[model samples]
Target: MVTSSSLVYLIGLPLFGAVFLLLMGRKADKWGHLFATAMSAGSFVLGLLHFFAMTNRSEEERPITQTLFTWIEAGDFKVDAALLLDQLSICFVLLISGVGTLIHIYSISYMSHDENRRRFFAYLNLFVASMLLLVLGNSYLNLYVGWEGVGLASYLLIGFWNQKPAYATASKKAFVMNRVGDMGLTIAIMIAFATMGTVSFDGVKEAVDRVGTPTLTAMGIMLLVAAAGKSAQFPLQAWLGDAMAGPTPVSALIHAATMVTAGVYLIVRSNFVFDAAPTAQLLVVIVGAITLIFGAIIGMAKDDIKKALAASTMSQIGYMIVAAGLGPAGYAFAIMHLLTHGFFKAGMFLGAGSVMHGMNDEVNMRKYGGLRKMMPITFATFGLGYLAIIGVPPFAGFYSKDEIIATAFNSGGAQGIILGSVTLLGAVITAFYMTRVMVLTFSGKPRWDDGVHPHESPALMWLPMALLAIGSVTAGYLFTQGEALVHWLSPLFAKKGEYDELMPHSVVTVLAITAVIIGVTAALMKYQFKSVDSVVPTDVSLATRLARNDLGQDVVNEALFMRPGQALTEGIVAIDERVVDGAVRGIGAMTVGSGATLRRTQSGYVRSYAALILLGALVLLAGIWVVTQ
Candidate 1:
């Protein structure tokens, strides 16, 4: 039987941990991280139990909701603070709590040396709690609360080392850019409420057919904007790379596994709206296509290991967004990829942290070479993640990513062909850049800086990496080999037979493999035996220069948004000072001057006061006599 209170514990445990840690302050420093890790593991355990309970029920009876209390009530409008546990949300819950548990464990060792480790664990608990809320909410308003909660948690974690100006700036940038998306979400919610008189998912789904197409289109586009901002899609993606300024476990948790996946979850959860608005769905495809390529190009030029991985994350998320836009045919696959990505990407990020721990916290790939011997466990685990991400057969990414590409081809028409080709090319580029990272960081002659020593990390760190690597290798096959995930997620999406393929699955698979081979071959040919310089050179080609500058995204943002915004702000300030404040000041000055004149007339002499009173009375009497005449 499905328990009503299970969902509450899923979200509540981590929050309890956070509050407990926060209340304990530094007093709990000795065991705070361990407590946080235990809380995360507990949430995951509850999630697993709940998942089994839901699976025992028939598909129609799978979705279970629990209403805690009324959150808002005004006239005809009302919303409940409720949680939904169904096929879709269940997937996300496991991913968040499961991967989050591992990240928390990794952070214990990764952040062992820091003075404020307790605070860091607290932030991790908060992040997990927020993400759980985001996916489990039964209503859009509830989702938004969780959404902003995740954003706030990310800012706190990203800027945890607030001593550095760059880290603080990155946190602020992430917050501001996400706000731009949050506004879109807010507008979408308002439109949903205004047009349909409901903000709950079930209510909207029931009412969507009756809503006008234009309104649906607007909702879809606005939702896409929100997704792009949170997921780091094109135009709003510049902040993600800089987010690497945080500790590596932060990168693993927030950027790789949890927070960045919020966008994909949002789109998938709102599939009913996008299914009705083809134009909006088309825009999602376009954004994904552009960003996948955009992220790949930037990834190719990045010298920092974390920045390269961050770029790869953008590209990979772009693929998932593309799948989500393909309508029902792609939602399940999008989620599958998202789950697998959480595994492999988090493993790789943690692997990067392990490398950094060994190498005096160096991030530049140029400073690393042939440390595979020095850190065998890290190398082995990172390689598995790398293979999975590159879509090699039998690895997790192969099943999920190849399915996306094949589904793209199945979209049919010139649009399908074009999108398919672009995605295929992205696969090639992904291989090249990811291979470059592995080869540079683990292969070739040692190019370490003088006197720098490298060694292995503690079991606390590598042990989690090993577990994630196992997932990276096996998750793909288990999910897709027999369309197991597709069937499992069927209740959330349309039937599989409804989608038609433009090409045979085998042909598409062959094409995808070929692309991977080409990319891997190109990377090996260029860097296999080559030694990299410890310092980056100032001189470069134009394309290289562009890549190094993130294709001038900052410049474009400044020119298109920042400068114009600054000018508008300056004008508003001027108007406020001269027009608004000036009017108030002028009125105040007049009142003060009139008071001064009246004061002069009221000179302390009793004769003067009496004379003024007589004059006033005489004038009043003369006016009264004239009126009477």
Candidate 2:
């Protein structure tokens, strides 16, 4: 039986660790690592057990839901603190907890020398637990709690190097941008409650089915806003690009594996709602397409190793969102892509981190080269990641990315075809930038300052990269299993209904192989043969300049949004200090003045008090006598 006890452990373990670290402080550093790591591992094992147990059970027992207690109740409304274990949730469980364990283990070695290792592990553990809650939650309210918790963890981890002002600012930016997206989600939840009578998943889904199209459209749009925020879509994507300020492992966990994927999960979880609203699905496609192109273009100009990876992460997430809009076939493609992405993206980020570790935290590509010889393992693994992400033949990205693109082409009509073309071009760009990264950072003459020696990272760092690299190569092959990826995820997507099977196997294989060859050729021409160093012209065209400057998006946000916000905050504070405080002070002064005039009548003498008392008594007696008359 699926136990409520497992749900409690998922949330409680990390929280207990956080409290334990707070109480123990620096003295508990080693124990904190031990406790946090063990708890994370334990949670992963439980999740695995839950997954296997469900697989052996019948359809009636497929969904194992555990309700701990009632969280909120009033009138006819109620939402329970519940957790769910199904094929869908189990997938998330494996991703978050399994990868989370490796991250923790890597952190043990990676963070060993840092002074605040205890606190670092604490936040890491908490992040994993919260993400687990997010995916496992049976209701939106509980999911939101986990959602905000992951945000909190992201803020903490991004600013983990708080001694640096830039890191701190990056952390704040992530939190603020997410809050902007969250407002939309909160409003959507309220709409669900008002119309549907409850916030629970079953209630909301049933209510949505009953309320018809308009309500579904509204819900879908609001959710899209939320997903846009969480997934780092077009308008709100700046924070994610800057999130490179955090540790490499953090970038892996938050961007690649857990937090950013929350948006895709949210959309997948609410598949039925999107099915009813074509407009909402269209919006998803539009925003995702825009982000895909934009991210790919900007990625080309990023000279920082992590920032380029960050841009690519956003670009890949765009593809996932596009698939999510494609109905059941698309949704399954998106989840499969999420799986492959987690493997490859995490590997890339961690490998980049290992590079940074060996180079004394130097991340700029212009400052380094000729390290492939020294860091053979890192280079090999990272190259594998590059191949997978670029959808090179037989790699993980090939199966999933192709499925989404093909499905989008067919389902989205002519507009879908255009989107598919842009995505195809994006694959080319993905190859170019990745090759640029490898070439600029590893192939050229040593660009380091005099007296510097760069070498391979420690064993602990490379181990995770190695494992992820393997997944990056192998995960997509799971799609080639019985009936492909879509068939595997069929149960979760209720709205798929009766649909034509996807294109024949031979057609899909030919298209996928052709795309891979094209991507590889583009990369080879751009980096290997055309030579990035020699090909870049000194006088760039305006279009090239715009791409070089990240399409000037950062400048616009700073001028229109970020700067104005700072100014507005300053103005509000000034008003609070000058106008509001002054007004309150004036009121206090007036009361004091009135009291002074009244005090003049109170002479410090017993006769004065007696006179006032006698006058009051005489008035009372006169009133009584007049009444009697």
Candidate 3:
């Protein structure tokens, strides 16, 4: 591997922009947004240069690292403040910087009217810089810094309009839940250092096989916990829908395009550990499978456009997670889905923002209807994205998501059958909910409120959506052409030796396609052919109510964890105040009582001393006589 000093610029440029904007405060308001966009664009350009350089190098030398200093050192342990750029890291670099730049441009128009647009841009720059650090860090310890950085930035952006009490609460919910995941990562890193005696990627790779499966499994589970929080998988996914309380640009950049995929990246990066630990691998698959359906079911019942998309994001990330967990056969496909997902999902989010722009920031899809004629650019861009997400032919998701399903089936056992069925089920539900979004938002009769007028967004906003829409249509085909991405990433993974397929690839594709059609048809029959209620129906089934409330995830949490946690905390406080403190107070009272009894002996010392001396002399004479006898 080649060593270079230039990788720092990829993160530094954006970080500098953020610091500069924040330091200047109101003085930079006129220029901050533009400057932040330029910084992100510059990082993207730098990533391109490094990517080209990697392409020119021989396969074995494509990976490069830069060590700035020793970050930590103790007896028999060391970690460096360093950067890594290889086939895998390079993908994230481009995606974070490139898509991030587009979101910045979109925000330039989106948040122009807000009073704190300058600070908003600064947070955007900070977020991009932090995510770059996450992907570029050479060691897990170094990556933790970036991980926390991204979390902080997300909290800032999500609560940017913290004036609203609900928005503030939403941001806090996301922050606290993510910290739960971060603890898992912290433990995993400690395990690596304790067992393997190293925390760097190269070191971990070498030591994975040397360690036993139980240790690896433990490490893998911890890593999965981290991934679950960041990626919004089952049980840890409740914070995601509420996270849509953020601005649309933040949704596109942080939730859809970049930050949400951190888990998938983490899993793929730790392929060696998962490959060695079969039980851990199975657990990863289980989490993914459960979340895929969990998110899809919730998406089906959402009336808020952004929340619906957020649920879809959760489900898609599940697909990537399942692929990543399937060992070597899936590593590349998982990343492929992630990259393509970034393009389409970010574009669709931008499209949603444009619709909201025209409709006075209303988020309810139930209030929208026949907007296709009013917002042509949004309709076209969002339509492409919808097709891609539903696994339509010649679209991005088809190539990437299809391969994931095929790989799940190829695992070869009852496990394969269950997994493959679960993936196809997820696909069906995905199509239904996404199609439901389309029908309610852009199709059917006009249901908008009075005084509402819909129009296309300004060029500054739609232009980014346009660009991302193009990527949505083309990225998958490009990735799969001649197996391009798989080969590029193949060198990093242990060989995926030949294995028997439970079914033919063609058969799997057919099944996935058929499932999608059924879903689309089901949604259309209910929502398109039948009239949709302009107001959400209260007289619905128990299942619909459950889905509407995110499967009562919050209720479950309150019952299972939050309430119990609060009671436990109260009990601990009681013990400290009564049992622990009362004992100490009792000891203090006893000491005070003893001291009081002795105090009288010291009063009026002269007379008291004479009497005491006389008594002592008499006692001494008596003792001497007794001794003589």
Best by lDDT: 3
TM-score of 3: 0.94
Q: Is candidate 1 or candidate 2 better by lDDT?
A: 1
Off by over 4 Å in 1: 1-3, 587-629
State each model's C-alpha RMSD to the native.
3.2, 5.5, 2.8
Worst 10 residues of 1 by lDDT: 493-502
lDDT (tens digit, per residue) of candidate 2 on 1-629? 34545656766776677677767898897578888888888888877887777778775567777888888889888888898877778888888888888788778877888989899988988898789889989888999999999999999999999899999999999999999889878988998888887887777777776887888899899999899999999788888987888878899998777799899999989888888898998898888888888888888877788988888999999999988987776888889989899989989898888888878888887777777997999999999998889887689988778777777656645775687677777777777777778887778677775666788888887888898899899998876566455655687776464434444545655665666567566656655564344234558778778877778878998999989999999999999998999899989999999999999998999998999999999999999999998
User: How far does residue 13 in candidate 1 sit from its true spot (Å)?
Assistant: 0.5
Q: Select the stronger candidate by lDDT from 1 and 3.
A: 3
- Model 3 per-residue lDDT tens digits across residues 1-629: 79998999999999999999999999999989999999999999999999999999999999999998988889878888999999999999999999999999999999999989999999999999999999999989888899999999999989999999999999999999999999999999999999999999899999988999999999999999999999999879999899999999999999998999999999999999999998989999999999999999999999999999999999999999999999999999999999999999999999999999999999999999899999999999999999999999889999999999999999988889899999999999999999999999999998999999999999999999999999999999999999999999999999997879768999998999999999999999999998988998999999999999999999998999999999999999999999999899989989999899988788877988999999999999999999998
If scored against the real structure, what TM-score would every candidate get?
0.94, 0.88, 0.94
Q: Taking the tens digit of each residue's C-alpha lDDT, what string does model 1 give over 64-89?
A: 88888999999999999999988988
Better of 1 and 2 by TM-score: 1
Segments of candidate 3 deviating more than 4 angstroms: 581-629
TM-score-wise, the better of 2 and 3 is 3
Q: What is the lDDT of residue 263 in candidate 2?
A: 93
Q: Sort the predicted structures by lDDT, highest score first.
A: 3, 1, 2
lDDT of 3 at 607: 84
In order, the Cα lDDT scores of the candidates are 0.92, 0.82, 0.95
